[model samples]
Target chain A: MVIINGEEQNAAGLTVAEVLARGDYNAARVAVEKNGLLVPKREFGGAVVSDGDVLEIVAFFGGG
Target chain B: MIPAKEEMLAALKERIGGDLLEKFQSSAAAVCGLGGLGSNIAVSLARAGVGRLFLYDFDDVDVTNLNRQQYKASQIGMSKADALRENLLEIAPYTEIISQKVKITEDNALPLLKDADVICEAFDKAESKAMLCNLVLEKLPEKYLVAASGLSGLGTGNSILTRRVSERFYICGDGESDVDTCGTLFAPRVCLCASHQALAALRILAGLYDV
Candidate 1:
């Protein structure tokens, strides 16, 4: 299981894109972190989730 | 010429206590985007007599921004940093206002914010906000970052809140309302988020970080 945003998920070996798709997060508006390291937007598709990994996602929105 | 420096300090000390006021007046805060949120945050910190303000913005005051931003009608074409500096100096002449008309990027983010004790991320775009937040979170680990996200639309004022996302990062906004879907960004709601960012920055500057 992968821990995403502090919640456990059965996402071992799944790509970040798949995880984001499952969570319904707006990909364009978020910054993803894999285990304490920031995952740039370009790497989301190729990066895969592994068991016991922690992920933190922050969403950004328009306006000052 | 409103009052003497000693008189103003005495009044501030009377209101906020001398110790905390000193802390507030000794630290500096960097406002990355001199738009609605940045302008409001700068004003609050200036009134509290934050020793220095690094106001950075590359845009000029547009006619449309007059609705929510702090720019005056006469300063329509003036750069945001310069215009805000002029306005803030009028309010708190002693508070050093350093305005920079330049855009922030990952390469220059660290050096640009090196001297700030607290940084306010008030960009108008999601990409810019994410870039600055990610850069500061990774590169400038010693400084505190007060960022705003999902602060668009006419949402309930109470919904706009300040959340301590990490030891050094604080996010202030509803975390849901985006301008893309909301179709509008009103002054009242924008200012609400700005107030949250301002308070968080001030609290950090005062050595009170528990938000």
Candidate 2:
């Protein structure tokens, strides 16, 4: 199992795109980092999530 | 020797003294984007005697900012941070002002925010504001950040609201207005938003909220 946003998930073999699709959020609005390395938006479909990986995702909205 | 909290509290009581003043005297704040909203917020904080202020702005004062900004026409062409510092000093000569005339980016964000007890995000651009907020939230989750949005025009008074979006994040101003529709801001609305931002900062510094 892997953690997506601190929740334990069974989708360890899923790609970043799959995870975003499951969450119903656009990949462009978020910046994802896997273990401190930024996963570019273009590579979301190709980048795969593995077990014991720490992921941090940030979403942007209207702000000052 | 460091004065007792009670003694400091008493001195502050002569003015804004109380639990809020006590908390404010010990707090350090960083304000980014010294435009209309940011300038007003800095002035309010200085008047309230916030212990230290870290002011950041890369732009020079322009003719358009005079309508709502706390700055004057004479300040045109001067660095916004410098002008704000001068104005704030007139209100609270004892308070410390750390002025930085530079654009905030990932590389310098930590350096500018290292000692800030609270960060006030007052940048105008959506992309820059979002980037800074995301960086601060991701890298410094424990730090409190108050941001503003939707303060673009003169509209219904009820449009303004100060909301706590998360434990460490808060936002103020109307969410419906934008720069496109609002044209330029008037004094009343900008001041209202600035007051809300100041109140939020005061509350956060006094530990009124868990965040």
- Highest-scoring model, lDDT: 1
Q: Which is the leading candidate under TM-score? A: 1
Every prediction: chain A TM-score: 0.91, 0.87
Scored by lDDT, model 1 comes in at 0.88
**Model 1 CA deviation exceeding 4 Å by range:** A15-17, A26-28, A34-54
Q: In terms of DockQ, which candidate is strongest?
A: 1
- How do the residues A1-64 of candidate 2 rate in per-residue lDDT, one tens digit apiece? 7776667887788999998888886564555667755576668889999989766554433323
In candidate 1, list every pair of residues with a backbone clash.
none
Cα lDDT tens digits, model 1, A1-64, are 8988789989999999889998898787777778766677778899999999988878898888
Clashing pairs in 2: B12-B17, B13-B17
Per-residue lDDT of candidate 1, residues B1-211 (tens digit): 4788889889988998988888988898999999989998899899987988999999999999998898899999999999999899888878888899999987877878999999999998998998898778777778898999978887788899888766787899998888877889899999999999999988887778898
Clashes of 1: 0
TM-score of chain B, per candidate? 0.97, 0.91
Count of clashes in candidate 2: 2
Tell me how far the alpha carbon of residue B202 in candidate 2 is from the true structure, in angstroms, after superposition. Answer: 0.6
Question: Worst lDDT window (10 residues) for model 1 chain B?
Answer: B134-143
All models, RMSD in angstroms: 2.1, 6.3
